[model samples]
Target: MRKKALKAAFPHTLPVMAGYLFLGIGFGILLESKGFSFLWAFFMSVIIYAGSMQYAGIDLLAAGASPLYTAMMTLIIQIRHLFYGLSLIEKYKSAGKKKPLLIHELTDETYSLVCSCEPPKDVDPSLFYLFISMLDHSYWIIGCTLGALLGSLFTFNTAGIDFVMTALFIVIFTNQWLEQKDHRPAVIGVACSAVCLVLFGPDRFIIPAMISIALILTVFRRSLEKEASDHEDP
Candidate 1:
């Protein structure tokens, strides 16, 4: 069952693997350029495990940000995970011993893949999810470590490499849009974000955008679910 689950999970994570490795390498290089070692890259990828926040962290470390400030910024940056976790509570209720790890490793990419893909025949859903999480995590660790090592050995222009994460997100969003017949959720998200961006500016928009998206989705959940069901029917 585990073997089958791993096989099924690997293909779903390939896109993420490509993204994470490149992004992770970029992160490692950035960290290394800041005088941190490859071990820092490996440990952060394992312990912190948040792509965006980890990128932010390098700046924080360099400036010697206070722990309280770091904690607050981390919360603000990762607040969207609250919504992600809420959406998955039902799906992960039966995860048992694996629930904690699942919650720990539920990055944006992993969440998208797990929510969209299901286990094949005779494959345990829990195992499939776990395998996907583990594989994605490993890719990131390897990427970050390799990037750090490369940075130490060679000199190259490292400007704008951080944009890889943004590019990966665009790809994920486009893929999701193509895969789902229902576009209302996507439309809602984009509209809310755009409005918030204009109103609050870039730095302050994320939390408000997330709140609005969650509220709107909840308000229209029944109708959206019905529409999706109708579309799925023959």
Candidate 2:
């Protein structure tokens, strides 16, 4: 039974393991340098496993920050996942009683696999997908723990390591831009955020900007598409 589970998990596990190693190790090193311990890194990787969130977590945890502030900030950082999960609810619900747990494990890698794979009938694919998600998450935790322990003992400068999250976002943005024809929504996000930032200050602007951007995009989606069509015709 375990062997079958492992076999079913391999394809998805392979990509996640490969991508997360460098990322997790980098996060571990940064955490250690920032005065957090190996345990903190390991647990954060297992529980949070959120690359950008872990980066921000360092500062928040360091200051013994307020609950309201932490919740607000975490919401701003991770609200994108709400959109990702929304698109998956119907698809994931086919898993019956196990669906909620699977949804909880729905990281980027898992989502890609579930979306891309055409599972064999009678295979209980939701369970298979869950196995992959769990394995990849374990690999990430192991990598982070190893890196943090090694980092603490070795004592090296880890200044630029903080850029992992920034680089990750830039790559995501670039990929979206390359594939998307009508870039109006992306432009609107940037502009709305910019205006909100100027008005409300950085600490308080993200939620407002996100709400306004979502509303504006939905309201003007057809117009934006028409504008793009007109530009192409011209």
Alpha-carbon runs more than 4 Å astray in model 2: 1-5, 152-234
lDDT of 2 by residue, 1-234 (tens): 545656766864665675666567777878888888999998898778776687788889878999999998888887767766876777677778777667666676666666555455555677776777777778778778888888556456655654544554465567677876878787897899999999999777877887898899789979986887786784
TM-score of every candidate: 0.88, 0.65
Which portions of model 1 miss their true places by more than 4 Å? Answer: 152-181, 228-234
Best by TM-score: 1
Error of 1 at 34 (Å): 1.8
lDDT of each: 0.89, 0.74
What number of backbone clashes does candidate 2 have, counting pairs of residues 3 or more apart or in separate chains?
0
lDDT of 1: 0.89
Task: Using lDDT, give the best candidate's number.
Answer: 1
